[model samples]
Structure formats: structure tokens, C-alpha cells
Target: DQQVKQNSPSLSVQEGRISILNCDYTNSMFDYFLWYKKYPAEGPTFLISISSIKDKNEDGRFTVFLNKSAKHLSLHIVPSQPGDSAVYFCAALRGANSKLTFGKGITLSVRP
Candidate 1:
């Protein structure tokens, strides 16, 4: 069974708006959460992450919120832009050197 899931397959947002992506996990042992963005024919690029000890982490326009009790997490992008259009994935890790478990991914489309 898949431990991480992204229920929504896609999302659309206008330029300069906010884009919110969600994810859920079934493993309680996961101690770290990460978000990655990918474009067609390219590898995923790390975006942001949060440790289970913290509730939130932010970088520039990207922010990640984790609700440990609920086994849920979300990524928020403020002032979304056309360049932000890509496949976003949620990933979880148990410890250093451990492989990351990733969600299928959600495609975000930013229209002008």
C-alpha cells in the first residue's frame, strides 16, 4: 500500500494568486517531510521541507505546514506565477540516508 498520497491530481490558479497542495501519510515513523517540483523530462527539484519536531517551515514564497497528529501536510505558494506550473510531489523520510517515499504528484497550472 502507498504510504503517501496526493488526492488531487491537478490544480489551476491565476497568476499572482495562491496555490495550495495537500498530502497525507500513513506512517507515524516518518520524521521529515519534503516537497519537490518537477517539469517534464527533468528530475524533481527540492523545494521545502519540515521536520516532525516543527509545525511549519517557509522559504520565500513557499511554505510547508505539518499536522503530525493528523498525518497530514500541505504546501502553500503565495503569489503563484506561470513559472510555478509543474508537477508537485510530497515526500517523507524516516532518517538520514533513508529513501524518501513520495506521493504520486499534483500538477499545478498557472494561467495568466
Candidate 2:
């Protein structure tokens, strides 16, 4: 499953605000680097990570929403805190080899 994640490499946000991140695989030709090679195709070993609708699944202060129709997904951090600063990643499932393609990390910076 190829996805468009539009989050920039760096994000700065004030604490206690909403932080939204997006990524797109269709642009910039970065897709090639994200691919992995695996031998012998097997059935999907595990189901997709669906927790809180693949999820618009939310955990505490973080919420993730996947929009299949728009070919994208977004991660929302509400009331963003300084401790939340970190690099984040996105992944795509390669059904042929039952492998996953992971996008590079996008750094998040929160200001207090």
C-alpha cells in the first residue's frame, strides 16, 4: 500500500497547539529508496496496524487519520508538548513480497 505522507523534515510548533503532518509517496521519486527486497512471497503474516481506524486511531495526545480516497494519512498531536519532539516515520506495505516500505523520518520540534 503506497501512501502519501506530506510531513516536512522539520516541524516547529508551540506547545499546547495542534500539530498536523502529511506525507506523499507519489512525489519527488523518493519511493525507490523506500522499497525493500524480500524473497518468496508469502501470505500477509499480520494484519495491518489498525488501532484507533488504521486509526484516526488515537492514543492519549496523538491521533492518526488515514484517508484512502485522498491517498494520504495525517498524524495530529493536540496540545503539542516539548517532550513530543522526535523523528516520525510512515510505511507502505508491499504485497508482492509481504514487506513494508518505510519512509524517512520527519523531525518534529515543539517549543515551550
Candidate 3:
């Protein structure tokens, strides 16, 4: 089973601070990892991703890190703004299906 798990269903952070979200997986074969940001009624947009070959990737205020041995990953957003408040989903892609296996979804509240 390609079950990707997000242990926490929600997180709250203050504006201008760091927000960290975590994800775990049981499948070692999963080589491609992604984090997607979503709003109510809208589709998720790719935020940041790290290939199995790399340990970390970053873009602007967002960063992602992968630990293959632990089968875990995390997303970090620095100076999170109120605009960053949204549901974040951790996803993985492997095998023939480029289709992503997503966590149940977690709502992140950024308080101003």
C-alpha cells in the first residue's frame, strides 16, 4: 500500500514566523516527493519537491527536506504570511502511475 501519512490534521502559526509540516511514508520505492498548497474549492498547486537523489530543495520562503532512511519529509515556510494560510498536502509519486498519493490534508492557519 502506497500510503502517505500526515500525522497532524492541522497546524496554526503566527505571521512572520516559521511553519513546519511533516509527512511520513511506508513505501521506500517512492522516489519523487512533492508538497502542494491548496485553497477552498481550488485544486492543489505544486509548492516544492525533492527527488530521492537530493536531501533538500528550496524556493523563496519555502523549503523541503527528505530523509529516505526514515521515510519522512517536511516542509518549512519562513515568515509565513496570512496569505499562506491554506490546506497543505504532502504527495508522492512512484511506479507507472504518475498519479500522486496524498495525505488526508492539513489546514494551516496563519494568524496576523
Model 2 stretches astray by more than 4 angstroms: 1-7, 26-55, 94-98
Ranked candidates (TM-score, high to low):
1, 3, 2
Candidate 1 lDDT, 1-112, residue by residue in tens: 9999999999999999999999999999998999999999999999999999999999999999999999999999999999999999999998967989999999999999
What TM-score number comes out for model 2? 0.64
- The worst-scoring run of ten residues by lDDT in candidate 3 lies at 95-104
What tens-digit string does per-residue lDDT give for candidate 2 at 16-79? Answer: 9998766555533222212111223432222123221243566577666766545566767898
Per-model TM-score on C-alpha atoms: 0.97, 0.64, 0.95
Return the TM-score for candidate 3, rounded to 2 decimals: 0.95
Write the candidate numbers in order of decreasing lDDT.
1, 3, 2
Scored against the true structure, residue 66 in model 2 reaches a CA lDDT of: 62
Q: Which residue pairs collide in model 3, if any?
A: none
The model with the greatest TM-score is 1
